[model samples]
Target: MSAPYVLVLYYSRHGATRSMAQQIARGIEQAGIEARVRTVPPVSTQCEATLPAVPNEGDIYCTEADLKDCAGLALGSPTRFGNMASALKHFVDSTSGLWMSGALIGKPASVFSSTSSLHGGQETTLLSMMLPLMHHGMVIAGIPYSETALLNTQTGGTPYGATHVAGSDSNRPLDEHETTLCQAQGRHLGQLALKLQD
Candidate 1:
């Protein structure tokens, strides 16, 4: 079997969430494990709308195996009315088979999100993402106070998970404190996965 890996899965509409995923993946790699980053296709309202199997740019859609076999997971999405984006929730809702088989039981998982404003439901979105992972028997993790960024960050850091306060136009990139919290949450999740596996 291949070496264990942590899956960094997310849906990014304006790239801020994608940036957070990358930082989290970096921290996962620093924990001596592979980081498999994947993205989900956007949801369509049209009943018959179809999408190409491959995306035009950025990360490809996540596969069942990628999720089922992961040693850990970091799920991210843009905030949609204080919740995760539909694209990510759509992908997550399709994991019934994994849930039935208990493929993710005891695995460590973390959630992250990006919002248009500082108070724009970042924490609620993170909590929303955690629900499905919890149903799959995952051990949810959040950034502890040990990460000083959580205490000092005026913008995005939270005990629930890492977050980015993108400006109203959604053009803001992750600031230093946000980036540090993302890395710290990823590192903690990765380490926890290793410990649980052993």
Candidate 2:
């Protein structure tokens, strides 16, 4: 059988969230666990049509098995009016089967988000992402004050989760503090996953 892993699942529109996912995955790997990265497709205006099973490039779509089997989970999305984007939420909402089966119960989970402005609901979006995981009976994890970047970050770092201020144009790269927080959140969640397994 394969060793356990953390699933880094996210939805990115302009790519900042995707960058954060990569850094979080790096931290999970640092904890000596596999980081399985996955992304969800965008929502179409028409319900009759759907995205292809495989993405054209970048990470492929996340599957229920991916979520069910993960030792831990790191969920990310771009902020949309102080909430997670609809695409990520939609995918998560489809996990009722896992929730009913208690497949995710007891696993540690964390959330992260990127916003277009400094005050663009980074914390709220992170909180919004946590709601579904909570429903799945997963243990919630957050970046602790021990991560000094939470105190020093001028760009993005929060106790709710790791965050990135992507600027109004959605073009700003993640600053050093944002990157540090991402890794820190991932490491904390990964450690929790390892410790909780027993």
Candidate 3:
């Protein structure tokens, strides 16, 4: 068997969510566990248009095996109408086999989101992401109140999960508080994963 790792899987449209994923991965590594970063390809409304097997740039695509074998998971996505983007949701929906087998049962999982506006349903989106993991029987982890960033964050940090406000143009970067919360969530999940394995 391969060494256990946390899967940092996300779907990024403007890169803010992707940046948060990287920070989460850093925290997982800081916890002395491997972090496997992966992304899903954009979904097109038109069925005929398909993405290449490999993305031209950025993180490689996530595979079923990656999801099945992870020691823990950090799922992220851009908020769309108070929910996760279709691309990430599509990937999650494809994991029924894992769900049926309970492959993720007892594993730790957390969620994060990016939105173009501060009130763009960040918490709801985080909740939406959690539903699938719950169905798979994964233990959900969230940013705890003890994290000072959650108390002081002016931009984006929540008990549900880490978040980033990307501004209207989706050009805003993650603020210090947002970044800190993301890392904290990752580290907490990693620690939980290790302990649960014992």
Which residue pairs in candidate 2 collide?
A: none
lDDT of 3 by residue, 7-117 (tens): 999999989999999999999988889999999988777562366767899999999999999999999999999999999998899899999999999999999999998
Tens digits of per-residue lDDT for model 1, 52-143 = 65689988788999999999999999999999999898899989999999999999999999999889998889888899999999999999
Q: Candidate 3: where are CA atoms >4 Å away?
A: 45-50
Residue 89 of model 2: what lDDT? Answer: 83
Give the lDDT of residue 80 in candidate 3: 95
Please list the C-alpha lDDT of all candidates, in the order they appear. Answer: 0.91, 0.91, 0.92
lDDT for model 2, please: 0.91
Q: Name the weakest run of 10 consecutive residues (lDDT summed) in model 1.
A: 45-54
**Model 2: CA > 4 A from native:** 46-50
Candidate 3 minimal-lDDT segment of 10 residues: 45-54
Residue ranges of candidate 1 with Cα displaced over 4 Å: 45-50
